[model samples]
Every structure is written in structure tokens, then in C-alpha cells.
Target: MKKIIYLLILTLFYSCTVKYYGYVYDIDKKTPICNVRIKTIDSLNITYSNENGCFEIKLKEKVKELVFEKENYQAHNLRTLSIQSGEFMKELPFGDTIYLISKNSKYSRPKTTLPNNVYKK
Candidate 1:
């Protein structure tokens, strides 16, 4: 009976894993970015940030890298993240935020451009 109980406890302890919550923010504005896309580097798994710029992704086996992107923001490729799985509810440092650069001009001009000579007098 002791041997059976020990085996069950060990199996339960080693079988635990957790999905982490991630957040996306604008690097320059320091604000949350909504509707952002998130994907794994080595797999087809993909997820998106909600209105609050937060997302949760389950690590596929041992994948530790994710790529984030949105329409106007430059894609933020997160590589080589330090992963600590098996914790039921571990608190992550400020490292959960992924910063992204804007693809638009510094002036935040509209992405559209008029055809040549359209602005000609």
C-alpha cells in the first residue's frame, strides 16, 4: 500500500504544468496594445491579446519563444525566455510585458500615402 501511494504522489507532482499570462504594451507610449497577435516560434499555435492587452498561452511541450504583432506596430519577436514550469501559480516579474515599436512615422501620420503628384500645385 505504501509503494502504491508513493508512486501516485510522485506522478501527480511531476505531471503539473502551467500556462503563463502575457501582456503587450507600446514601447513609446507605455500603454497596453489591444488586439495584438501572439504565436509560438516553432509551432502553429497562435493567440491574441484582449482589449486590455493581455493574453494566455500554453507552452507546447518546451517552447519558450513567442512572436507578437499587430497591424501598425512592428512585430515583437520574443526569444529566449526563462521558463519555470510545474508551478501551480507562480508570480512572474515585470518580464511579462512585451514591448513593441510603432511602424508608423514618428509623427504618427496616417499609414496611407497619396499618389505622386497628387499634392502637386
Candidate 2:
């Protein structure tokens, strides 16, 4: 009886945690973006993409939101619920591809020429 109860508890604990695997990429370039930060919005769980842009994060089932960030790129927010709503791919083992938009592409300004007199030391 004790062994049965222990097994049940172990199964419940294991089922409470979920692992999400995916790769990050540049939206415009269609190339992998390495070192992107992935974190749970409501928890301390965090991980980073590798040189190949592959990453895996283990989060509690209760965590509904994820935030992805990187330098010079726009931050992306993903809701777990969207996956169930068919907004995101349902595949797990094969993983998903997350695209990030470069900040420069979104907010580029025209260059202005400066006067030569301003170059005086």
C-alpha cells in the first residue's frame, strides 16, 4: 500500500512539470539567433539558446506565459494557452521555431550629415 501511494505521488509530481523545446530565429533573415533568453513570466525558470539557437525550458504546468528576449531584437511574449487554441504548433519532440524582429528594422532613422566644422578637435 505504501509503495502504491509513493508511485502515485511520483507520477503526479512528474506530470506537473512540462518541458518546452524550440529554436530562435531572425524573422527577416530566417537564420538562427543564438543566446536568446527564454523565461517564464510568472516563475523563476529561465534558459538560453545555444549557438545553434536550440533551447529547452522546464516549467510548471501552471506557468501560462513565456517571455523571449535578446539584444537588438524585439522581445516576444508567448502564451501557453495559444498552443491549445491552435495558434502555435502542437508538436513537442520536434520543437518549434520562434522568430524575433530586429529592433533596427522596426525603428530605423535616416542618417543626417554633420558639418565639417564640428570635427575640429
Candidate 3:
């Protein structure tokens, strides 16, 4: 009776979903940073952080690498993070707080830094 109800609730809470929530903010101000591009490395799924600097995306089970970029901010690379089977929500913080200042001309960009957030076809 009560045991069955508890199991049902637990199952419902742990069900897998194809959604992810992400956010970007100023390193110093802590204010929401809007218009950050969220590009899926492998697929064509693309999104932008809203004014509140938050975004939600749907993806299959795989490593997801989310890139946070802005015009004036120094581009910060974040490694792909894994999400659990029963848990669909995951948060990825950059190795260090990203401060976007002037651009670096001597920087060499890599073709790919992290694996795509979905399974390979």
C-alpha cells in the first residue's frame, strides 16, 4: 500500500527526459549574461541564452559540450559533461570563471575540444 505509492513517486521523479538547463553569467558582476551561444558540437542543435542567461535544450544520451561565447568576452571552453540515466538534469561549470575582455590574436583555435552531447550516428 504505502510502499507501492512510494515506489511510484520515485519512478516518476527518476524518469529520463531529453532536456537540459544551462545558464551564463558575468564572472565579476554575477549578473545574467544574455546572448551566449549554445552550440551542440556534433548536431545542428543550436540555442542562445535568454535575457536571464538561461536556456533549456533536448538531447539524447551522450557527452554534451556547451560553448559559451560573447563578442567582448574571452571565449571560454568547457569540457563535455555526462548526465545520468535516471537523472536528466546536469550543470557544467567552466574550469575557471570566464572573463571576456580583449581578444587574443595569437590564440590558435582547435577544431574540436569536447565530444558532442549526443550519441554518434
Candidate 4:
């Protein structure tokens, strides 16, 4: 009975271990975006991107979805995130560079005044 219980406990512990992994990048610039805030969709377990725009969060819950947010950037959802697996006891690379679109990058075209309009011709 003791061995059975121990096996069950070990299985449960390993099964719940999850590593949230990804890199954040600027959608337009095509460069890594650092210091981006990443968290579970429910607002739990927050983490930030490193200088290389890489991040890994170890989680006990089964949160497969996350949101990346930053100032002057649009919030992004990594909805296609995968389920937790493996038992190497460490974070692993998942997929894709998470992209964030900057709100401050909006471009407004300058109005061009013709020479004829200035002379009132």
C-alpha cells in the first residue's frame, strides 16, 4: 500500500509540472522585445522577457494560454500554446516568437501643399 501511494504521488507531481516557454518580439521591427510582461490569461503567474526576449515560467497549474503585454504595445494572446509534457524537471522551448504590435508605431502621412495652391492659381 505504501509503495502504491508513493507511485501515485510521484505521478501526480510530475504530471502537474509545466514549463511556459517562448520569446517575445516586435511585430514590425522583427527584433526581440525585452521586458515584456507575460502571464496566464487569468492574471496569475507573471513573468518578464529577458534581454534576449526569452522567458520561461514553471507552473503547477495547467495554464496553456498566456498574454503578453507592454506599454505602447498591443496586448497579444498566445492562444495556440501547447499542453505541458515531459519530466526532465526543467523548462523547454515551445514554439514561435511571440509578436507584439507597438501602438506608438503608427505613421501619419504628411500633407503635401502644391506650389499652385500657395500662389492661388
The candidate scoring highest on TM-score is 2
What tens digits encode model 3's per-residue C-alpha lDDT throughout 5-116?
9999988766654565666777556778788776677647777778987776566553456566778676665555656787765666533333333343334343556678
TM-score of each: 0.59, 0.65, 0.50, 0.62
- Model 1, residue pairs in steric clash: none
Clashes of each: 0, 0, 4, 0
Over 1-121, each residue of candidate 1 has an lDDT whose tens digit, in order, gives: 9999999999876666446577888877888988888887754888888888898876535455678879977776765446356544434443478878787637344558779999898
Mark the regions of model 2 whose C-alpha exceeds 4 Å error after superposition.
1-12, 82-94, 106-121
Per-residue C-alpha lDDT of model 4 across residues 2-113, encoded as one tens digit per residue: 9999999999898887877878888778799889998887786899999899988778865546788898787877753344565433323475677788876543234467
Deviation of model 1 at 71, angstroms: 0.8
Error of 4 at 98 (Å): 0.9
Estimate candidate 3's alpha-carbon lDDT, on a 0 to 1 scale.
0.63
Q: What TM value does model 1 have?
A: 0.59
* lDDT, each prediction: 0.72, 0.81, 0.63, 0.77
Highest lDDT model number? 2
The better-scoring model by lDDT among 2 and 3 is 2
